[model samples]
Target: MKTIEIKGSFRKELGKKNSKLIRKEGYVPCVIYDKENNLHFQVHENSFQKLVYTPEAHLVKLLIDDQEINAILQDMQFHPVTDKIIHADFMKTYDHMPIVISIPVAITGDSVGVKAGGKLIVKRRHLKVKGLAEHLPENLTVDISELKINHSIKVGDLAYDNIELLDPKVTTVVSIASSRVALKTEGEEVAEEETTEEETAEDKDKEKKS
Candidate 1:
């Protein structure tokens, strides 16, 4: 996992008015919870976006009053109307402690099924994984080069060291289906019916001429 360093200032006042003032100053209100010490501290808001938008799960290096802590973004609140971030919460990470996080799924290689006129469908975009924060991956990659039509990649087929996927073992991650072929087959059936009707009308006209 990657780590990002963000500087945060301690907040003195609490409640809606003070939080509103913080946002008006272009800062966000945040809190950090340390399970080891059972401590929670209020922090400023601007130091959050880097952790929020990254594709990779990150361990944040939080610097407060010259003290540094390793933590993860736990939860956040957004304005219902404006969608602006309102508040955020962080959980401290400890070595050897297990944590659950969602990791992105990356599709790799050109699939044979796609080349053979099968449409590739991604069933799951991310996997929920449980493991030590340090050992957890930013994203899991699945190779689909050998996939054939009607074949699927399941969660049970994936193997990662020191990480356990929380998704059901039988759950499909990706699969190849014959969507376009089915549509073409339906079209061909309609054309054949039209052709038969035209032939029947022509035969009747020839009989009448005789």
Candidate 2:
């Protein structure tokens, strides 16, 4: 797993007023919960963009007042209207401890279905997995070169050597779909629509006769 450096300050005061003041100064109030105790801290809001906005799961090296702890982002709070981050919470991780996190899914190779003019649809963009920090991966890749029309890759079909997938086995991850393959399908759809309209008109005529 890749690591990101986050430098912050340890906060001694705890209250809504103090938190509000910290936020007004463009800082986010954060907490790191460990097995022993909860540590309160504050980090600049601008410094959190790379960690929060990215799709990759990154191990955090939280540097607080010259002391560092290995942690992962557990939760965060945002303003309802503005969608700005207000607070963050982190969980301390150890070398031997296994933790669950969402890992991005990378689609590799052009699908055979796509070459047949069928649109490739990805049903799932990420999956939850559990593994130790050292064994975690940046992304899980799925080869779609052999996929044909109406074929799907499900969660049950995936296997990772280092991590355990927490998603349901039956869950679909990617597939190929779309009726708009060519002009033939379009003509068939138009004929179907015309038949439906004719049936509807006949029903209306029967109702009038009744």
Candidate 3:
């Protein structure tokens, strides 16, 4: 995977008040969890633009107090209203150990189904995979050049050396949906919309609790 550098300073105090103060200063409180100890630090919000806004996975080079740490972003919290990032959590990584992360899926060729008047639908923009940090890729490529109408590319069809796909083998990553199939799935789309609303409510509750 690609690497990005971030500079931060060790946080002397850790609490809600201290964290609020840090945010007021345009910094985000962050933690790096390790097997031995957890490191607390604060980084400028601007420093996360490339790391947080991008779809591709990246190994982070965290510079804290003149020390370097290799880690991966584990979780992030954002403000409920403005959607500004409030806090971030990272997990320390080792060269020999395995890491699990979602890698962006890059669609490479034109689909044959589209040329046949079928609609191309992406079911997954990313896929969760587990592998050593050195073996993980920046992005996973999916070729749909030969996909025909009503056909799909499932997780089971993909293969990568030294990387294990974590999603279910039956899960479809992309499909060429014919108009007839699209009409048949209208009710399912409505059900999905309801589920999304429920998830949004749950996220708002989590933000309030935090």
**lDDT (0-100) at residue 20 of candidate 2?**
98
Best by lDDT: 3
Predictions in order: lDDT: 0.82, 0.90, 0.94
Cα lDDT tens digits, model 3, 1-210, are: 889999999999999999999999999999999999999999999999999999788999999988999999999999999899999999999999999998999998999878766799999999999999999999999999999888999999999999999999999999998876555466577899999999999999999999
74 Cα displacement, candidate 3 (Å): 1.0
lDDT of 2 by residue, 1-210 (tens): 799999999998989999999999999999999989999999999989999898777889999998989999989999999898999999998988998888889899998878777788889998999999999888899999999878899999999887899999999999988556734565787999999999999999999999
What TM-score do all the candidates reach, one by one?
A: 0.76, 0.82, 0.83
Candidate 1, residues 1-210, lDDT tens digits: the string is 888888877777777898888788877788887754533345555466678776667777888776888877778899899887888888888777888777889899898878767799999988999899879887899999999888999999999999999999999999989778755765787999999999999999999999
lDDT of 1: 0.82
Minimum summed lDDT over a 10-residue window in model 3 is located at 179-188
- Model 3, residue 154: distance off in Å is 0.6
Ranking by lDDT: 3, 2, 1
What are the clash counts of all predictions, listed in order? 1, 0, 0
Query: lDDT (0-100) at residue 136 of candidate 2?
Result: 86
